[model samples]
Target chain A: MDPDPTIAAIARWSGIAPPNEAARIGLADNAALITEIEAMRGTMGFEEEPSDFKAALRDCREPTP
Target chain B: MNAPVAVTDLASLSMTEAADAFATGEVAATALVEACLARIDAHDAVVNSVIRLDREAALEAAAAADAARAAGRPLGKLAGVPMMHKDMYYRAGRVSSCGSKIRRDFIPGVTATVLERLDAAGAIDMGTLNMAEFAQNPTGHNAHFGHCHNPWDPAYCTGGSSSGSGAGVAARFFYAALGSDTGGSIRLPATLCGVTGLKGTQTRVSRAGVMPLSFSCDNVGPLVRTARDAARFMAVTAGHDPRDPTSAREPVPDYEAALTGDIRGLRIAVCETFFLDGADAPVVAAFEAALDALRARGAVVTRISASSMRAINAYTAMVSRVEGAAIHANWMREHPGDYAIHLSARLFGGYAFPAHLYVEALSRRGPLLRQFVAEALTGHDIVATPTLKTRVPTLAETDIDADPANWSRFMAVSANTRPFNYLGLPTISIPCGFDDRGLPIGLQLAGRPFAEATVLKAADAFQRETGWHCKAPAL
Candidate 1:
């Protein structure tokens, strides 16, 4: 039988060697990470700006008593 | 004036206390270095926390410090204090393996900005401490270097990728050690080892010349024996660094001076949703005790809800995974076997993330932070949680490569910590109590962005009311 297509596609696209069975199992378990990412897909508006590298400093000066 | 304390007693002094002794000329710097070296020699065999010990150079530096003090020259706040750092921080003409075989002999010409800051503050660099490979893992099981055993108990984990920082501090081998937190590395080890760790608001400290894990989440901080020590360490190391453009340019506060021990009207919110979900019973008991301690110090504690945190915690990994994979793209392609199996597995999945998803994760950071702040911290000064939802696991339990079935246990170590990294807020972890197994549990206090002073002040107040931070591991 052929290898799992999901694993094969990941191997081919990444150009890294195919992970061994243990590694493959761990990778397969990242479904929750993917699900979270998918849920936030369009939650952001275009008007909303991404965080800047200097955002920390800006937020620091955000005026708190 | 009284006579100088003995070198044997130096191990018992906190970093702030030791530095004060140094400033008063009560003890020679040479004695401090020798005492720490002796402790490392006697205890490090079991802890496996140190990667390198620059004995000769450290002693020489100590002598120089003594001479400078005798000459009546100005001294740095950390003058004569001995410390080792996580192996990932690069120093010129020194080996920084970063707990990875691939970089065994890698030496960078420039020292990390944080190292330069510590050097300027008169801190002695004894050597490098152990960490997870590429600062990747949270439970401190480095396949390249032997796992860092907890000083409290050799069988349990030291918590990583700042494993050595935690263990070495608990062992009293050094006053403080720098631990980088991408997702709870510093805080986890601090909690597990019964020390204190502070992860300032993201970019509060420069990351120039340090190893990168996730560009967005990486933070530089210290794991020390007391919140006061962490406060002083942050004051010295925080602020803008031209060397690191991402470093915040905010004026550094006198973190040590901020510890007034009065937290009157300090409102701390406890979210009963995601943070406390499935938390271990013992951990819950310890966290409530910590709240009581804080309340005794005039801090108002209330329960609140931040429903968005569940999604926040879940999405935190995507940013780090994608960025870490990109950082190691070349190495992953060429020397895949050089990495530990579990680390390789985690990085492998990073390659599977879609570009838009990576961008989405990054772009949504601001909105999510705003949402979380509005939900959790609108009427509160800080949010409190258990640093780890569960007790510290054994090295055997978290060694995923040894048995992949342990993945959930391994992943759980950072569940409470990762969300703060995502929110880019200043957070701290301090020992609260021990679990049924006698492993240390940590209380986490997170503040509004760049409100590190508030975080440290509250922590110091709690420390004043409780002796948990004063309890040393029976190494």
Candidate 2:
């Protein structure tokens, strides 16, 4: 079993750069991050290449009409 | 009743008084500047708070502000009001250490957007205050430059990345100081050190020229003596900066005007769950007292379940770890030797995690925010809680090198406030009262997105009704 693959998976999905190779196991890369991303309740798997970017709203002041 | 050299608590002294004294053949900017510099000279050695100082440059700026007043051309809102920028903000020709040794000696030729505005307002920069390396840790401890000690109790921690900003203001070294809030950097310090600090909603203030922590979570604000002072500083710094790609095009509102009203009819939320759960006694008591006082003062207060906060950890776990890792990826790969052992190891391990977790974390955030907005704040104006569960932890307790529980305690106290950063809300941590040990515990007042005015008004009213902000460290 490749611990490195699991380590890479946690960093890719969770975004917290784990401390080192070993820390990816628990330290900064805890169990919550180790769980499969799609395993969470209703998340569709990667094969379902969903369309749009989860666009966040940016506040912009448009001139009054 | 006034001592001859009473260190003027810049929060207590009206800017007008300082300016008047300076102009009316009474006080000199050099005198005030020297006193502040003297503060850095005497106390900072023990506090170990200042990361960078330009003594010669500060003196020259003070003299210039004094001489400009003599020239009679009107100066800015904070004319001759000595101020310092948090180390995250780049000041050209100054080493703006983001508390990371990687850029420890790297000086910039460009000034941070907010620092430039503060300078334009005639505020003199004294130095760059210390923060957690990479603005990651909530504790004020920096392994490289040493930790920033709490002024209230030098043995304890001053909540961090903006730890020095909080400590500097609470110790009354400068009139005002700038800080960044990502995962509650500004507010944690304010709460720990007993000062007023603000965290603007996303893009409410410019982030240009400041080092990045979590791009989506980052905001620039102030730690000052009063919310009014924070507002005054925000008014000058919140305008659109062409240098910032994400900066809002909105006109900056007069935040000072937001402070003039009483919070008599405002609908404030008293959190029932996350903020209230697993709590410390004195902090809860002080927070309740503050809430009761607000109620007595005619503000309508209701206890609401803060389910939104539950999602905070998930959001933070998703965004910051990723962004923080991204910012340091190149550095982590190349000069891994530069990072403090704990931080480098932490970031390295964080980067090793699956990318899917990050995307899933992001996916969770949208729904989490929606639930929070619906359940916690339908018609509410703001949410309030003790800024931290407990008072400042002693260095013996919070030192990463000491006991493992210390680092755990440091992370636990910061958990309650990180949710607000994830949602990108404006929050102010104001000193409600001191603990039995005479150390300060803060009450965090957070409002809806773009509700900076409401939050400032509520904080200003609380300050008006209390004297906590008026108290300064004896040191």
Candidate 3:
């Protein structure tokens, strides 16, 4: 696959260069992870925020003995 | 009064045992410190576990502890026990190299809150231990500091990024050590080195004054010889610190008191899915035997399905990678050559992810954790797995720096332990059995979020029935 253009754009806009060919190849696993996360795009509700994880942990805790 | 335990045996005692001996005047703090120092002096050259050894300071502190005891003054919970933490935990005015050359001379102005708590409990600070540079890698390969060798066999990998904590504790250099876990840093080392390590629920312990690799995934915990030691260590360190506002405010329970050794009727689920997929035969045999041991203790074991693990693993990698890249952005731009080649490459990939994808990874954490708990843990009090899906690997085989072909084995080292990081549940790894190569295998026990006591209870009960944790490496 061609190097993901969006990654290059983000790296350029952020003032950091993209990984070299070897390093980019090393990221093949991460590329698969990105694809997996991308597959779940619409599953999350609009109101959901990262902080909800803390609440979820508390809510799911085993009842205090 | 009972006869005093031999000084040569002091280093072999568990953290709680050593502390209790000190409390009852069976052994002086000085003797315990001396015993640990002697062990390090004898074996650390082979293990390469210590980055620094505060020999004089530890001796002085032990003397002070003895004086306090002689004066009938109150002693802290861990009074007189020796510990060495991963170098990332800062002690004011001391250099915490964080296993990286870039920070070799960087000194912090404050001591880590966990260290302060450990001091209050009377644990001696022997020095800092080696780790993956910047805690970036899963295997214990540090370019600045030499690789931490497994005490069992010097040629094998110690597992990382909490390399020294695992190897040192297994080598009997100290009673316990602090290890930071993000993507199996603590548990992997614990598994590979054959000891007990606990990563409490996310934010269960304070991160103040500790190094940060990932804000969301980082957890501070202990690597020790036994589950009871882990329980006691957690009791002293697991609570909110005002300095770390992100730390959970959940009431810390009496973790030690929870080890009643009666695990009868406790439900355990073994996910016959992602955790066991591609598991080597020896690892599977060891893991099955571990489940049988737990079953003999009257614990119920059920094979269950967990479909969310793939997502959990993916999100975990995405979030930690993005956060780690952002954390190291300025450093990478300025001192790019200072980091190891493998580390730079890993962070380079981190810089490639889109911003929204990072957000999506974070945003989906709650939902995935909810799904996991519902599917795998709703009926089970604990979920069990092989801490490492394969038997221990030799350093030569997993050294990515020497050859990039080693990447798959290096990354696979943390496969069984990484998903739990994203789920943010309380998990512990204890020695189950050894592999065909005589390397140790670990049985992992993960419980509901914040249920550290239940997790500790089960692990302690298992340790009571098995001699795995007591089998020290022949250094």
Give the winner by lDDT. 3
Quote the positional error of residue B307 for candidate 3 in Å: 1.8
* Candidate 3 clashes between residue pairs 3 or more apart in a chain or in different chains: none
Alpha-carbon runs more than 4 Å astray in model 2: A1-29, A32-40, A43-65, B1-27, B363-367, B403-405
Least accurate 10 contiguous residues by lDDT in model 3 chain B: B1-10
The digit string of per-residue lDDT tens for model 3 on B1-475 reads: 1134554588998888898889999899999999999999999999999999999999999999999999999999999999999999999999999999999998999999999999999999999999999998888999998999999999999999999999999999999999999999999999999999999999999999999999999999999998888988999998989999999999998888888899999999999879999999999999999999999999999999888887777777778888998999998777878888788878877877777767877787888889999999998899999999998999999877788777788888888888888899999999999999889999999999999999999999999899999899999
Give the per-residue lDDT of model 2 (tens digit) for B1-475: 1123344543345343454456554566777788788777878877777877878888998888878878887778777877776788987887877887887888988888888888888888888888888788888878888888999988888998798888988876777888888888899999989999999877788888888888878889999888877777888889678899787665777777777657778888887887877777888899999998788767999888864564455547667877787787777767777777557655654565457756755665545555566666666788888899876677667665444444456567687778887777778999999888888999899876666777888898888788888887877
Pick by DockQ: which candidate is best? 3
Model 1 chain B: weakest 10-residue lDDT segment is B1-10
lDDT winner between 1 and 3, please give it: 3
lDDT-superior candidate, 2 or 3: 3
- Which regions of candidate 3 fall more than 4 Å away from where they truly are? A1-7, A18-22, A34-51, B1-8
